[model samples]
Every structure is written in structure tokens, then in C-alpha cells.
Target: MTETTKQPIRVALVDDYDVVLTGLAHMFDRYRDRIVICEIDANAELSDQVDIVLYDSFAQPESDRQELAALVRNPRASRVVVYTWNFQPELVESARTQGTHGYLSKTLPARELVAALEAVHAGERVVSEPPSKRVGSAPGLDWPGRHEGFTERESEILALITQGKSNAEVAALTYLSVNTIKSYIREIYRRIGAASRTQAVLWGVAHGFSPDHHRIDHWLGGP
Candidate 1:
């Protein structure tokens, strides 16, 4: 008797930023035989039925139970996994309580990410070891404002501001100090030639800083 080959895990990437989801989708390119990116949803509905929905938590509130609950309730997704940089104990427990199958770190390499997803698809609840405070984002990831000389963190701050998040709200969401958020905002203003928050919002809106609401199916040749 011959053993049957396992099928690649169908995955849907979920996030509000197109650049963030697209960059994440690229990380799985080398693992195409094991993971197939079925959809890339940006503030959009999960249209396809997939084995896993990898929710990238970029520029989103870490403690958003409503969003997590919605994903968990989606019948199209067999499981929901959080891909985040913030690993606060409360946040992890909240995700678990909300029925997330995995709470993975953003510092995981592409290969390790694929393996973790495989474990999730195999019915195992996977959680990555907490990454060090000094660890940055995984290599080869991209975000908006990269071409404008904004670091990923700075871009996140700007993106939040564009979404009408106050300085305190941004601090709370990203776990950054208010002073630090202000400093990043100052630098963002300088780089974008904006001196006021309204100006910054206008600039961000014009420069693709707002959250997207569409699917990037074409990235993986989906119809």
C-alpha cells in the first residue's frame, strides 16, 4: 500500500495594510510546496475557505476581542492564528481564550513560520517562544512609507495617526510610550513636510497610509 501525499495548507493572509499582507505573502514563496497562499485580505471578508487564516497584527489593536471573535466565528477559516510582535501575557491569553489556534511572533523566520503553520493545520496549538525586546521584524518584510525613508515603526505610527488614532491611542495600541510616539510623529512630520496632525493625515491619506479594503488575490495568481 502506498502512502498518500499531504496537500499544501491553504492559507489566507488577513490584515488592514496591503503592503504588510503582501510582504507576508512573499515570505512563504519558498515554501510553496507546503503552504499555498489562497488569499490576501485587507480589511475585507475572507472569501475563500482555507485551512488557516494568518492574521497579521500590524498597526492593529492587540487586545481587540471583537476582531478576533469575528475571525474565530468565520466558517470559511478552519483556524485563526495571530502573527504579531507584541507578546504580552494578557494578549496571548486573550487570543487563546478567543479561540486562536496559534499566537506566533513576528520575529519567526520564513521556514519556522511555515513549520508553525503546519503544526496548526495538524491540529496542534502552537505558540512561539517570546522574542527578545531587541528583536526587530522578520527580514524581507515591507511596509508603507519604506520608500520615503520611514522605518517600520515610524510607518506604523503614521499609519495609526492617519486612521484617526490619537497619540495616546497609538501608544496604547503599539505598547510604545506616549513620548516615544510623539517623537516618531515628529520625525514623520519632518519626513513628510507636514507640521500639523491634520496635514499629516492628509498626507497619509494621499500616500496609501489608510487601511485597505480589498483582496490581493492576483499576487498568488488567484482569480
Candidate 2:
């Protein structure tokens, strides 16, 4: 398709890790003629910045429903899509309810990824079928936190920390105080044998602690 006739979809990537962002940038580089990545950001808000915001959840199993809702509710963002590995049935439905235009698996090749983005830009709600089974054991590995005696609260904190949130940001998102967030991080580090945030993030990524099993009420404080 001619560049004039086929306009590349403008995409903005949202991921906490620099590596993910950089990798995605390179992956999509070949499709520059079809898709243009306008920006890469960790912040949740972008006022009409681009045609689509792709939220990557490689390390995050639980889709942050609140963040998805906010992006959909904002008139500025034209479209929002969750690029994730977590396709729990309920999570997919919850994301749709919150205005996500698409839910795609990370396993999709770059060409399919581009097609999905194009479909979303065309105003379709796209949810790719999950693989009949997880490709390999590598994707489903979970940290033995429960067996390690970690509490539900600790699990939630670890999830957010892995997503690269600061103590203040985690406190704001979870409706807890900064000091409380710090204390939880300390205890989590001690239990998990992590000496720093980087170590904790790496552990979380490895063991799938990035996706906490949180009810909406747990983070949103609803009845």
C-alpha cells in the first residue's frame, strides 16, 4: 500500500521496564511503514497523544483495570489495547468493560501484532484466542510466595513494585501511606531474599509475581 493511501497507525507503548520498551521498539522497527510508535511512557495518562496506547503486561499478570478504565474514559486517547500474557477469562472481560479496544497475546508475531493494532484502530474490540495450552513451562512459572509465607498484601506490593512503581505511586494506587508501602517492601525483600528494588523486580518477573491476585476492592476500595 502506498504511504499516502495506507497510513501507519500511531502507537504509544506503555511498559515499566526499559528493556521491554526498547525490545518492542526494535521489533516494530521493521514495520515502520505500517505502524509508527509515537511515544514510549510509563505514565498512565496521555492527553490525545496518539491513536493507540499499547499497555504491555509481560510481567504483570493482573491487568490494572483502573488504569485501563482511566485511559478509555479519557477522551484524549483514541484507543487502548492490553498487550499481555494474562488471558484469564475474567480478566479479559474486565478489561473490555473498562474500554480496552483490544486484548492480544505477547506470543503473536510482529505481523499479527500490527494487524491487531490496525483492527483496533478500525474500531474493533479484539481478543485473540489463547493458545490451547501455554507454549512451555517458562511462561507459567510462579513464585512460591504463598509457600514462602507471604501474605496477600505482600503479594500485591510485590506486583506493583515489579511494575516499576515508586513507593509514593504504589501508596497512591493502593490507598495506603508511603510509609506503609516502604515497610511492606522491606518485609517483602526480607522474605524473598531481595536486597534492592532491581533484585525484587527481577525475581517478580521470573516467578510471575508481577500479576497479583487482587480483587477490585483490594485496590479500588469498593464494597
Candidate 3:
């Protein structure tokens, strides 16, 4: 749906690391008109705070069933989603049994992530795309220095630029306007000390921001 026609979904993000919360908040910035991030906390009292609670397990991917259950029990939020890098089928099933409304992959771009959260808020169960249904490997932008100064959106755009994608292609991938892509690129170049796209690509490759080898299991699911 177009942003103009959609209702803004109230969301609360729960993650242990401050950096993760900050990055997620920044990543969702563009969707402020459609997705309102009402809270960012490690242990927030979500009762009555949001329509959906996104529980991101940045460090430990597995063994969060009890935590998920607790979040589900909270009366503040109507739904809960486990947003993580690990989407093993067993883990997904375990989270479902624990009453999580959704299980999402970390590899999902900002648009898809927002869509999944909206679906959960609508009283639907959402799961990450299984490995076999997925197409060819997407750029694995999860590299070192990700926690550095660059925002999550900047890192994602840089990853696409390093892949030699033009601004239009990057816009399409990110579901953003071309003008927005250009603006972001300008800022990214300034931050990374690059005078041109070639220089940006070089900087990204040198600093380990380039996509790494794709593992079959990784394609199956997870961040």
C-alpha cells in the first residue's frame, strides 16, 4: 500500500544492545509517516505502549522462548514479533508455540520488515521466507564495522553501491525515491571520505563492508 493510504502502525523495539536500538530507530526513520516507533528499550513495559512489539535478538539467536512468552503475556502490546538473525525452522516453531505473532529475518530490508510488523498487528502470523523459496543470494552486508558511525540505512546503501548498482537500482531495492537515494549517497560519500562511487566502493571493500560469501544455511534464514 502507498504510504499516503496506510495507517501508521505503532511499534516498540526491544533489544539488549543500545547500538542495535539506535540503528533500528534510524532505519525506520524514513517510514515515520507510516510506522511510528513509539519506544526503544531493552526492558520496556510495553503494556498499552504500542500495537506491536519487535523483539530483536541481536546477540543470542536461540534460547529466548521464555522471554518471548513473557513479552506475549504483556498486556500493553497486542502483538509481538521476534526479529532476529536466526530463523531456523525449529526456532520459528518454538517461538510460535511461545505465542509470538511473527518471526522475521534480520536480512529483511526496511520495507519488508515494516510490512511484516504490520501484518502481525493485523492479527496474522508472519514467518520469514524459507530458504528454498528465496531467489539468488542478496548482498550479505552484515560485515565488520557495521556498528561503526554509519547508520544502518547508510551501510545498506553503501553495500548496494559497492555492488555497482546505479542509483535507480538502489532505490528500487530499498523501495525509496531516486532523490532520496541520491541524498543518502551524498551523505555516505561524505562520511566515508569518498569523492566518487568508485572511491566509495574501494573504501567499502577495504573496510570489510562488501558482501561476503553466501552460505546455503544462511540463505535458509536468519540475519
Each model's lDDT comes to 0.90, 0.68, 0.68
Q: Higher-lDDT candidate among 1 and 2?
A: 1
Q: Which ten residues in a row have the lowest lDDT in candidate 1?
A: 214-223
Give one digit per residue, the lDDT tens place, for model 2 in 58-86: 43444577677777877767998997655
Error of 1 at 92 (Å): 1.3
Better of 1 and 3 by lDDT: 1
Among these predictions, the greatest TM-score belongs to 1
Q: List model 1 lDDT by residue over 1-223, tens digit each.
A: 9999988899999999988988999998888889999989998888888899999888788689999999999999999999988898989999999999999999999999999999999999999999997868898788888888887778889999999999999998887799999889988989989979999999999988999998877456632
Query: What's the candidate order when arranged by decreasing TM-score?
Result: 1, 2, 3
lDDT of 3 by residue, 86-157 (tens): 556677788888888888877787888877877887789998876443322223323234656775557667
Local error of candidate 3 at 84, Å? 1.5
Per-residue error (Å), model 1, residue 119: 1.0
Q: Report the CA-based lDDT of candidate 2 relative to the real structure.
A: 0.68
Over 4 Å off, model 3: 1-6, 131-223
Name the regions of candidate 1 deviating beyond 4 angstroms. Answer: none
